[model samples]
Target chain A: MSHVQGDAKKLLARVRRIGGQLGSVERAIAEGAECGAVLQQLAAVRGAVNGLIFQMMEGHLTAHVGGQDSGMPEEELAPVLAVLRSYMK
Target chain B: MSHVQGDAKKLLARVRRIGGQLGSVERAIAEGAECGAVLQQLAAVRGAVNGLIFQMMEGHLTAHVGGQDSGMPEEELAPVLAVLRSYMK
Candidate 1:
């Protein structure tokens, strides 16, 4: 496993937070919370999820693509980077 | 706007890739790809999304929660970390 995988416990902790945020959204909807408030919570969830995505990409770049001992050539890394770039947007 | 926001271009590139992946899945369904093939592609998209989510969470931790000189104390960070843990799982 890679370093990220090795740190799964920490990573999973973050994921759980996202889930909890989602549950809050669900509850807000069910409880008839104000539309604006619900929307804000939803946006927060989106931002949090985006944060997680960014971290994973950084890890991949550091450990797999740009690591000092990485055997991956620039040509191969280019396409992966391209995909990563788009996903982040 | 912090370091991550400054690097938005690269992050957006990754987001676009996810979009493209979703498009491919759509096309596969429209073209009547074999059920197994379609399912496999869908799974790939799921993994890609999960990867993106992981990246985002890591960035939040380093930049917002644990950055050098951050004023936020561990007590505040703990609740955030707890939420993240659940989201990851």
Candidate 2:
């Protein structure tokens, strides 16, 4: 069975952090915060989110496609590849 | 040794596609492509890359942190978490 997975506590914490960042962005806009400051925070949030994305991507590669010992066959690897290819398009 | 990982052929194909898209972007800019068209392509590229990132992230979680059978302990999973946390910063 493909079990439910992931570091739940950690993921939750990440969501919280991102949420706070977004909140700050909203507040900045609501309170007439400097454009530079607002943009800087937004960029930070984007970068942070991207960083998380990379980690998850790396983890996925290690688990499914690369496999622990038995490598995923070409046929099985196709969907995984298709997923990646779609993003590049 | 963390053996060389990822689907080389597939990854190569992805890079090629992304490269082509980027080239198109460059050409569009050079040829004074319409702002709307340029923005649309840029957005498409961003979305595509994000999709790839999600796949990788999902794979990593499945392989390492989730584990096929033996669940990774909290101690062992810390580094993985740290990586994730950094991204969400």
Candidate 3:
């Protein structure tokens, strides 16, 4: 598989795992687990999820956006930038 | 500002706007706006937000992770990877 697709799959898997954690946290909250403990676990889950997000975004920049010396042709950057702009909107 | 910092600030601003959009969506649902319209707007907001996230991730990979021809030295990729791993957890 292409590197981008592989990376995306890895990210999706990680996200799914985090989704499970979120569900568990929700259940914990519903069950009235100790507030502090529950909050702590929830915070960890959030951090983990955010971290994966950060990495995925970073991966996109490297693999697609082609910064200073990406070796990728300038023309290729347009479609990527176009996608980014669409997202920003 | 450093390019990385500038990009991050722009990303954060975009995210905050999306957060507002989410809040508005909640308000719309609370007030009983047409479900179809509200869901449509909510979907648009989600798409937009995800798009920005995609861009930001791409930027991080380019600026920090240093793909194939990155003028960045190998050692530089370590700390970034470390941080990414932390996030993954």
Candidate 4:
């Protein structure tokens, strides 16, 4: 149970929801759904994935940054954290 | 077809890929995948979906913030576009 595994059940649930959202998007197009509705679904999926990313990103941060116990000095850890932040969002 | 519907087949394919990525993520967790590997998959899905979001967001901009023919003046469109930009990414 590494710190990177943050509530695996929760993560799996979010992934399932994202999968369902994608399926809905497909169905929307097939049914000749209007553009506004389709676009809204896509945006919703993106928001869900972004939330999942942030959740996993937090796990990475806690493991590598390892809080007070981390042997890596601030100067070294700062750049790593900076790079991670840039990518996560 | 209104401007908001940009290549439905292409959009559907991307959605499918995102769905597949999510499925893979679920499998990884179920199989007791290592933390680093799971995180990598999460990041990959995020990138794929981000690309999809940009595509749809572009459609939204073109349709609503429509170019020269749009009646919306700069003052009105500016804030609208700005708000869209803030949300899309």
Candidate 5:
């Protein structure tokens, strides 16, 4: 967590929001919300989680893997970024 | 919840797994795991959530707008499925 940089406050807020979203999702399902509504809520959560990943990636890239400053080669970064992209989609 | 079909057992299991994954992410972050590892965990969680969405979509589709047998026109089902597909990615 300490290693992660760039707007820690925003990241913390996003994490809290995700927790709350997950809670709502559980409640919606438990209380028997319609299938459509449940799916919508789940999708929203998915989007939120995806946003968080993007933020983390941005922060990491700026701090450690900035293209100009990083000693690591493009080939090395490519596979890592690809893995991140795969999770994102 | 009742409207969703095609495996209540599996859906419940997926939900529980997601909850557990979230807990692990939180724990890992708190324990000061490396940035790459945290991202890995978060990505894994994201995939888990996406998998849950797909399962939910399948279950809902089977019960409701199932092609041919659903009594729903293609035009009507198309947009609904499109929305689901957008979230899935």
Candidate 6:
């Protein structure tokens, strides 16, 4: 299996948390929490989803595209890593 | 501005890479690369998107939900962190 598939359990766990955060957002809205409070929860959910995307991207690049095993030089990988690191910022 | 917004440049860079990866997949298909090859590219794109999602989630949790400045106790944060760490694994 590819590295991402091998790590499916962990990835799924993260997705589950994202799901939970979404549910929290819903509950917050339903309960008529302050607008600011509900927005905070929503923002949190968005962030979580973004985080998941970042992790998947990094794994794909390292394991599938370039890695120590892939014999790709650091010089070749540097720009990609820079982009990724910036993206995670 | 929120931390995520403050880091928008980096995040956008990551998103751009994801866009580039997606385009590569399209090009691979157009060139009629072998099924396995195309599949590999597609998988990489998927992983990249997932990586982005993962990073967003972690940032939200730390910067928005709980953090050193948030004054939330580590005891309270532990379960959430555990969930996130497991998700990232």
Most accurate candidate by TM-score: 5
True contacts kept of 5: 0.34
Q: Using lDDT, give the best candidate's number.
A: 4
Best by DockQ: 4
**Residue-wise lDDT of candidate 3 within A1-89, one digit each (tens)?**
63458787787888888988888889998999999988888888967766675566456545543556654455654554454333322
**Which ranges of candidate 1 are over 4 A from the true structure?**
A71-89, B1-89
Structural RMSD, model 5: 5.6
lDDT of 1 by residue, A20-76 (tens): 765665565455554445446645656655555555555656666676678886677
lDDT of 5 by residue, B1-89 (tens): 36553354566677777877777766666556677887898888788888778778766775667657678866776688777767655
- TM-score, chain B only, every model? 0.71, 0.66, 0.62, 0.71, 0.69, 0.79
Ordered from best to worst DockQ, the candidate numbers read: 4, 5, 3, 2, 6, 1
Select the stronger candidate by TM-score from 1 and 3: 1
Query: What tier of docking accuracy does candidate 1 attain?
Result: incorrect
**Candidate 5: where are CA atoms >4 Å away?**
A5-10, A71-89, B5-9, B67-69, B72-89
Candidate 3 lDDT, tens digit per residue, B48-72?
7656755654565455335566544
A41 Cα displacement, candidate 5 (Å): 0.7
Candidate 3: give the clashing pairs.
A57-B57, A57-B58, A58-B57, A58-B61, A60-B58, A61-B58, A62-B62
RMSD of each: 16.0, 10.3, 12.7, 5.1, 5.6, 13.3
> Which of the two, 3 or 6, has more TM-score?
6
Clashing pairs in 4: none
Off by over 4 Å in 4: A4-6, A72-89, B3-6, B63-89
Q: State the DockQ of every prediction.
A: 0.03, 0.07, 0.13, 0.38, 0.32, 0.04
Q: Model 2: per-residue lDDT, tens digit, A1-89?
A: 22115655666687789899999999999999999999999998987676556446545444544454533443544555455333322
